[model samples]
Target: MTTTQLAPISARAQFRPGLTPAGLVTVLLGAALPIIDFFIVNVALPTINADLHASTATLELVVAAYGIAYAVLLVVGGRLGDSFGRRRLFLTGLWLFTLTSLACGLAPTATTLVIARAAQGAASALLLPQVLSIIQATTSGEERSRALGLFGATGGLSTVVGQLAGGALVAADLFGTGWRPIFLVNVPIGLVVLVLARRLPESRAHNPLGVDRLGTVLLAVTLISLLLPLMEGRALGWPAWTIALLVVSPFAAAAFVHVERRMERQGGTPLLPPSVMRLPSVRSGLMVAVPFFAAFGSFMFVYAMTLQEGLHFGPLGAGGALTPMAVAYFTVSMLSSRLVARYGPKVVPVGGAIVVVGMVALLCTTLAAWPQVTILDLAPSMVAIGVGNGLAMTTLFRIVLSHVPTDLAGVGSGVMTTNQQTSLALGVAVLGSLYAGFSESLGTRDAFALVIGVVAVLAAIVTVTARRLPDPRV
Candidate 1:
């Protein structure tokens, strides 16, 4: 069904009547910070380890803590926003995020940094979902599409920029702060965004739903079981508990789903209302998101390794190599709204085709130029993928929320973002593992080619699935 045809929710009546350009910009900035933070530490890990004298496990925690907290609490955060006020949660989370970032910057010990990172992640969970919910509630039609497009572009650019910016900040060590600058950099940005956020119109669900305490607990357990093992299994040598948790994760997820379904039957709010899953756009769009983001994560991980270990590029050099992709992605993303408006849902499949072509080109280049490939040699393939990424990502964001009820905007966004984040973590775990295994047996060039081939196949599958999405213009 088209979004316009969906039954109206009581909550939409309470939606603030106006959203200024400045207000939209403020929330968009809020959206960018959490995503950027997710990737910013990748290039700074080694420096953090050296500076803090952290053990390997603690170093891993520095990253894992943030990801786990962010992923686990996302849906709950959405629910909170729905129950409370989006603007209130946005400002509160932003403030907490800023404080935690400062704590991270000034942390003197590895333990302290890990603690601060975890808090930073918790704050992010509270902040990120509201961005999408606010836009979904406050904007419609072409304006909605444009705002969502900018959000997608912000996300893509943040991922690329996080790496590059992190490297640059660490290298510059402005005022002799060293890797501390990476975390500290967010302070001024956050302060500026906070001031701007005052302009945002407050919005909340009309008949506020009470917290789903039991369902929330079950979900936390489910996500932790699944993500913890995947994230830590490789590093911890695939421990028995990790395997056990992985095996139990599906059952835990099933239980959570069962509970949510039961809650719906009894006329209560569940953490993730199963009714939402019945929506074709939400289902198909999320299915497409999994593989798309999985490939994204794997590519970033493998590419970084290939650049640093295989090609011997330093952090700055490796991060810089992705500039072409970053530029292409930002450019296409800015124009994607027009593409979607003109062509509708067909943009996804077309973009997916472009991505496949780009992947093929990248794999071919690596095979042909093994041991001699440079950033310049890879620029064409990177640009192609970037263009594809921009189109697909922007279109997918709009398509997923195409028909969500206004009341459920926060939860819907939470569910979508959670799936994306989980897929990303899986990408690193699964594809990264595959690359590691293949490199040991088949060599780095062949391994990279094989991963690219696998990602290409996945991208092709996403294209096929995209064919099922209803045209947004309809």
Candidate 2:
């Protein structure tokens, strides 16, 4: 319970077999695929809809199914890695992801694509946590810090890259395959990474616990009950079933909490440990993560819609519009650690404030220019948002993991990522639906401006809460 008790764990970690540069790159590549896939489908959705003759609800499912499955299974995946081995789970996950990607590419129906996507999500859940767990287990001090920074940068940039890549692939229509290449492209990349991953060193918990069946089931039920209703309610015309599910969600979540606490009291491993959640750094960092990621997810989703549907941009143009933001994000993310080293955690609130400014700029521009606004006109605001995002996201990862004991690395990473992915899905469900509803009555331009304003408010909340994060020395 004291700082001295944790020192020996840190000292032992410093002597562990660490990742080679090649191995680090391999795992980071593994890290990128899932985050990229999440946003990649946004631009490709229209094309997928047309070719498969899919309905609105089905298209939403294409996105939601993967996200929901990934979010739900992440902690279990982490536990499996701890119980078996990180490298083993990583390789297994990569192979499964490749197969599922192929399944998605070759699917003849929308329903088939949704099922395949869910499988892909499961594979990702198995794959991603090991990246961080491996880093925590193998490296120490500056090396671990740098690895995590690069990991954060990969994650943030992948969101923009996903949409960009999706649009380019859809527009290329290679062999007249159209949007199918968006998923098909992953097959070769996954294979190459699988080969490279053979070199990664294996690590596992010293006393790995058995999987907690009741806890896993309850957590899944809680998330599904919450997310499914929000995602499908609008398209399904707010059915009685949706309302019932929504009503069930909170109770399910409470039950999950009670079970986890009880299991911990009984000296059994819960999917999420009460001890980890009780850490001030973990709890406060998560407080910042939820709203920040929710806003981020919704912003990306809604902005893509604005470009393609509202501005009438072609797929290529829509994706290309994000180029400025992507460039800024990459550049700033590389420099964010240096800034944190000097400025401490205050950098996060500053980043949040910058995001608000960018959102406000975007709102003003949208109001004034309407459908006439060009990508060139949007570049500055995009750059601002990108810079802000880069600064905040990298630091949030560090803060959450900063105090987590080495032995619980897998569980801690699992909890952090699950919170992140769940927030993303919820954002898309809530704000995306809000945008759609507003567009019907208020016109696309006004609806967009209103949503941007709401996003700005969320960013402001991030600014306020981030001020409370403990400023551990960089």
| lDDT (C-alpha) at residue 407 in model 2 | 67
Q: What TM value does model 1 have? A: 0.84
lDDT for every model? 0.77, 0.81
Model 2 local distance difference test score: 0.81
Candidate 1 wrongly placed segments (more than 4 Å): 1-25, 45-67, 106-118, 132-160, 175-178, 195-203, 405-407, 437-446
**Tens digit of lDDT per residue, candidate 2, span 320-361?**
887678778878888887898899899899999999999999
Steric clash pairs (candidate 2): none
Please provide, for model 1 over 399-470, each residue's C-alpha lDDT reduced to its tens digit, 9 standing for 90 to 100: 888787775665566667667666766676677767767788898888888889999998999889889987
Q: List the residue pairs that clash in candidate 1.
A: 11-206
